[model samples]
Target: MTMYSVDVYSGSSDSIIQDSHAQAVIVKATQGTGYVNPKCNHQVELAKSLGKKLGYYHYAGGGDPVAEADYFIDNINGYIGTGMLIIDWEGYQNSAFGNTTWVRRFVDRVHDRTGVWCVIYVSESALAQVANCANDCGVWVAKYASMTWGSWTVPNMAVSSGAFKFITGWQYTGGDMDRSIWYLDEAAWDKFAKANVANPTPSPQPKVDQAKPVVNPQTTWTDNLGDTWHAEDGKFISNTALHLRWGARPSASTIAVLPAGSVIKYDAWSRGNEFVYVRQPRGNGYGYVAVRNAHTGEAYGRFE
Candidate 1:
């Protein structure tokens, strides 16, 4: 029997449950923003409970492509039985930031490190930008024309440098409502996984301070390890007891329990309230954190 897969922006627990017919699910995680929409770890746990093959998609954000790829690895390094790490490249332009040559190199780096197949997700227009390097990556073309959510097809877009023919999947609709079939089954996924190796001893990451793109002083960011600091001022701090609550009221929602040294980004202060809105930027999206416990004075310099 042909296996099927569903791709959804992370955080749509209900949608994934509704589309339980699919054998696998791809959760979208964008750079600079952090793991797509579903920001909670429990959401991931819920998806796995459905007994579906699980994977993640990184929404290709422009700018330092390598940095973006690293963000993805940081968040999803330990996820087990992950399928191909789909790189959704729809918004890419032909400009400097959208350079296909650089994009391909970044994709290679991610695949080399993750031990998973790297698939490209793009529309016709976006595909043109990466026409030259398309052959280096698998293709997941998105072509939608129907009025309803799940009815669409994968057009015969050009892949790599040749007449594009091999397409693994098609995204026929938008949002969590779309539906499609998988071109590869579990055995295929296993083969692809075996072909690649995981955690290929990443090249020494550049020191964040000495690195360019100088951190914005206005924005304070944090890493996955609860290491809090101001990216711009080059100040690092440690807060042993920081907790993140969802929503405005104290009782609204309680999300993550952050330990000391976790990296985070400063979002905003609740209107006239004492709590600051901080987020964990895992390249997918942002996770909310409270400022009450984030004020600890311990600090560190550029993360290596």
Candidate 2:
């Protein structure tokens, strides 16, 4: 008897709990938002109560890869069941924010941080966009229906990528009528859990600076380098350094500078032994900024 599996999309009910006989259950969370379907918490708890092997599936939105990954981490962190994270790339066709590069990058980051095998769930169209990276990771091809053809035909889809045997599993249908049996049993779940380690370390948390008094809305300061600084909100530190070279460094980059009272929006901040780090607005692929001379800026008040 080959192992069989069933993937369930839990809406708001514990129907999966009733179908506890399935060897493995893939819980479908939200798609595109980069967050686990809010319905997953209920399903996860229900699956736990039923003692079933569980894996999570996220609908890929293909948008800003880092933001998507952060959304996933924020929602699904600390899930300790079968420990497999599945990325559903089937809906990439209409994604305004989705991109193949972002999808692959996000998956790589998630796998590196979580130590779980990130599986790609894609259809033939999506396959073309992400096929380059598919072999690098496990793939769950959605061939559906006997009418599909060529490599997309169920059997050929599994065999098209020689990296792995035809397919690890198949999704024959939706709901309780599914015909395939690729679900993982409890013993298999144990084996998978033991084989994969949760990332030994959790992702680093953002840091905050406490040494400097929060600058008020209208204050000015100068640095050793003679660069002027101004505080509008007492929370934002602005550089008034004149004649400063404009370019990107490991710490800071030149951006379109606003006037003295312009409002600056920052996502994170850090203070090191030598410098303070401010997250820069990403443009043209640049993502962060480091203020080499924090002494020049004054704050109106700490960002509320």
- Top-lDDT candidate index: 1
Candidate 1: tens digits of C-alpha lDDT, residues 49-134? 87777666776656567777788777776663455576666433212434666567667777667655576776543566656555
Model 2 worst lDDT run, 10 consecutive residues = 147-156
Candidate 1 has a TM-score of 0.54
Candidate 1 residue 294 C-alpha distance from true site, Å = 35
Residue 95 CA displacement from its true place in model 2, Å: 1.1
Error of 1 at 131 (Å): 3.1
Q: What is the C-alpha RMSD of each candidate to the true structure, in Å?
A: 17.8, 21.2
Best by TM-score: 1
